[model samples]
Target: MAVRELDDLDRAIVYALQENARKTSTSTIAERMDVAPSTVRTRIQALEADGVLTGYHAEIDYERTGLQLHTLLVCTAPVPEREELAERAQEVRGVVAVREVMTGQENVHIEAIGRDGDDLSRIGRELDEIGLTIEDEDLIRNEYETPYDGFNVASE
Candidate 1:
């Protein structure tokens, strides 16, 4: 499929929506960008159809939600087994996301949230059983995110 290019108004709309998708209505976004609400709606539908805007999600504070332990597991496996290992890691309890890194010594990065250290330990053991050798792991102390600006959008 051909890549659909986002126009200037699309970039502004995206930036506004990224700030707060649930609260930001099409009319609000259009008003901010000085465009019609119908135009904004059409562009948003087009963006979704072209797979540019995949999905809207809420950023939850896992720590506040009682899942206090958050970790990043850097593991290595044989190239052929890397994808399988990632998929297996997801099946392990507390494991949320498993990203396969194509290049580097650590081929897999697992993002896990747990109730405590024991929960994380169990996940680690499960990964080990799946033929993943944990090179290193880090406890996520905190996360900081900023509103997405239109910096990534190409200028016309």
Candidate 2:
């Protein structure tokens, strides 16, 4: 599909939603933007119809939910097999997220999960046998947490 243009208000609306998806309402946003609620609704519909507003979900706080380790299982694999590896990696225990990124000199990236050192090591070993080279590892610190909710349309 061709890329459509976004106006200032549209951008503002997207920004507001991205910040707090659960809190804002069209009426409330209209009030802040000094526009009518119907206008707010109209713009929102346009955004959604254009496939901009994908969806929403309640982002869970893993640390508070008994999730122990959150680490990436970076893999160096051929570009053609990225999707297959991602699908397989998802079934591994404790993985929070996965992506196919431009990993410097590598082609794909896989995020693995573990609650402790053993889990990380075990996953690494399994991945290595499958040609998934572990590039780097780190602890899942809350300091770098993002709610992962697609977007927010809450008030300013």
Candidate 3:
């Protein structure tokens, strides 16, 4: 389908949905906008078709699920070694997420979850060996208050 620009109503719908996907159902959105539910449904389907609404999934608390450790590793990668650094991070036992960043000097950012401090230290050391200067480390105590992204963007 062709990509069309979002109109005022479209932006409003998207904004409402971004705040709470479930709250803005076809009927609710129609009622709020004084339009027909089918119209709302059609627009929503079109939005999904256009890839604006990718998907949805539940958010679970990792700590409650025995995943208490959260560590952010901001490492600087030397020239032409990002792929190798990614591989090394993947080999780490409890690295949940590793992403190549676009920061001017920083090469990649790693978000890892280990069982204990020892695991974190192990990961830190691994990065050091790879010549990646570990810039910062922080514990993620609670990540529930982030802005609500109506669509699903999650790991497995």
- The best candidate by lDDT is 1
Model 3 spans with C-alpha error above 4 angstroms? 1-4, 78-100, 121-133, 144-156
- By TM-score, rank the candidates, best first: 1, 2, 3
Question: Over the stretch 1-156, how does candidate 2's per-residue lDDT look in tens digits?
Answer: 868687667766777776677998887778877889899889989999999788876766665766577675556776677667766766666665667786544555665556578877877777666655677776656534343333333332
TM-score for each candidate, following the candidate numbering? 0.85, 0.73, 0.64
| Model 1 Cα lDDT, one tens digit per residue, 45-87 | 9888888889888888899899988899999988988887788
User: How displaced is residue 19 in candidate 2, in Å?
Assistant: 0.7
For candidate 2, the TM-score is: 0.73
In candidate 2, stretches whose alpha carbon ends up further than 4 angstroms from where it belongs are: 121-131, 143-156
- Model 3 lDDT vs. the true structure? 0.74
RMSD of candidate 2 to the true fold? 4.4
- lDDT by residue for model 3 over 1-156, one digit each (tens)? 667787655665676677677656878767767888899888888888899778765666767777778878888886588768877877767777788876646777888887788878888887787677888888887665433443222211
Q: lDDT of each structure? A: 0.84, 0.68, 0.74
**Model 3 TM-score on a 0 to 1 scale:** 0.64
Task: Point to the candidate with the largest TM-score.
Answer: 1
In model 1, which regions exceed 4 Å deviation? Answer: 151-156
Q: RMSD to native for every prediction?
A: 2.6, 4.4, 6.6
